[model samples]
Target: MLLSDQAGQTAATKIPRPATLRESVIEAIQELIVSGQLKPGQHLVESELAELLGVSRQPVREALQQLSGEGWVDLHPGQGAFVHVPTVEEADQLLAVRALLETESARLAALHAGEDGVRRLRALCARGIAAVESDDVEAAVATNSELHAVVTALSGNQVLAELASQVARRVRWYHTPVARRRGMDSWQEHTALIDAIEAGDEDRAAQIMREHTEHTRASYMEQRGSQPVEPAPKPVRRRRPRTSPTD
Candidate 1:
């Protein structure tokens, strides 16, 4: 049955998806960033991005705004949008938060994970390890994220999982640089963590996860410390022009 709104627009059984084009463009840009195709601090040209993505400038503009809100892109007024470059402090703080949340998640996962969940984790671990072995940095990073996501899901805590999901991409951003360096060791730790969870050792699982996350945090800090920090340009706010009184 169709219903009419105050605007006299007919509402059928279905409604058009809101901001579908903008959302798709947002995902595409995020993928480019996460995969390192769009390097940090690289300028994002709206027209070029629109042409590349086969979308219009309007959607690209909207997507850049959304990405900026999410910290994936920085929009500088009068200048343009650029990919966000992670600071050492940002990486440390974010990873610290991740460790806290993931530790508890590991405890819950151990308490809640079933055999199928354990099997799935093992499969993800294998894929990550294989990616590292092949020196496929992008694949390794992606699989690493998947492995952590699965662990969070296994926790069976809806709220915790949601929070993890929110920060997962940012975490991926920081992990990209260290993927190759941390690869084998990271996956080995995943194996140990999975064993702990599979054995239902909550304490062990939490401890392992805490240590594993700390390792990544330390790696990021060390690596980023050596690199020069470039401050992101802030957007200039335009002021309204003053007018004289009319005669």
Candidate 2:
């Protein structure tokens, strides 16, 4: 049955199944870390995290352990949990892999992207530019990820998309550091990339993606100090539990 609120419009159908508490906590903590609310090397305490997330300590503890396995958190024997501090070596290796994967994705996307796909790319690029102009680093970072995800999905190669997804969040983690510094130039490169894809210039699209990813890699390596970056002030976050349509 559909339900209506004060406006008297259709407000609901069958409500979606809720995420398990542990899953919700895991997603929340991962978001906090990725969005830099939880900084690298900062300690994570179960009770505090539970309070922050309005969940039980059990789920928070489970989330931390799960995150540690995913390399987003560190669980020391006696010192408790800390946000994982990725190293220069780790960044270089992961970003290199991402570059290789995305270059091919761009090439295939150019070869195969339909008119609708091109339109979608243009829309995402515009949003990304606006985010950069507004100096909303988090929004910019999220849009950047969405744009790339679309590129890969347009490739129409399930294997390639899966490969890209594996590294996507890690790539976002690395991109967060360089988003503001890359600024308009990065989005301009994306504009060129979208144009190439729309024109079905596979080689040009591939080359643009390769160079763009490399520029991001160089910016990251150049901007990073000998330690984890000091995160900017945490932006206010409002989030809902994640759901998979297939679930």
Candidate 3:
């Protein structure tokens, strides 16, 4: 069956270069979690995930391991992986830390924000207000995160910005459920914070930011308390089919 072709030609050689399958699966699963398609504490069946992601079980397994290490998924001894259910304590601690970091960020931003920085903050605030007005909670929440991130960036402290970025995604996950409840008030607070920053009122900016984050934390806690936790199912072990010895 030899032909006029290289003997070592391979499937890998024929494929175009792009992200690895494992990385792609990881991002897909994260998106599922972030978008709330995969609820917290929901069971993750490898076969189901493989079918949904159009991938084989092997890459899904590897991605789950990576996600488990990253705190997004919990790997059980025999039950397999489930979405990590955030505890109230974990949310409170993270939000408290965010408040500390962001209040400092607001003060630094007031100290360093130039005309362009102020203008950018105002623009994000405008977008956030518009989203809220239109009742687009998701867009409003996203814009809210962007506005906070810009304030962090305007702080001009690389270390502070890095820390804020690390906690930002998880913050968004918790914030999404409560966005509508906080809607107009959240944007109103943003407007006031922008005003403080624009006026170079460092103390006022810090105070407003602290209050804003605290309000969000309270709203999230209230909403989390209202929702019921889904119970984890007992694992079912598969039984081998019995076969009789034949002579």
Candidate 3 structure quality by residue, lDDT tens digits, 70-109: 9899887778899998889989999999999999999999
Off by over 4 Å in 3: 1-20, 234-247
Ranking by lDDT: 3, 2, 1
TM-score of 2: 0.84
CA lDDT, candidate 3, residue 212? 96
Model 2 misplacement above 4 A: 1-18, 226-247
lDDT of 3 at 49: 99
lDDT per prediction?
Answer: 0.89, 0.90, 0.91
Better of 1 and 3 by lDDT: 3
Output the better candidate (2/3) by lDDT. 3
**TM-score for every candidate vs. truth?**
0.85, 0.84, 0.83
Which residue pairs overlap in candidate 2's backbone?
A: none
Which one is best on TM-score? 1
Of 2 and 3, the candidate ahead on TM-score is 2
**Residue pairs in candidate 1 whose N, alpha carbon or C atoms collide under 3 angstroms:** none
Q: Candidate 2 — worst ten consecutive residues by lDDT sum?
A: 226-235
Q: Choose the strongest candidate by lDDT.
A: 3
Model 1 poorest 10 in a row by lDDT:
1-10
User: Model 2: C-alpha RMSD to truth?
Assistant: 14.0
- Kindly indicate the candidate among 1 and 3 with the higher TM-score: 1
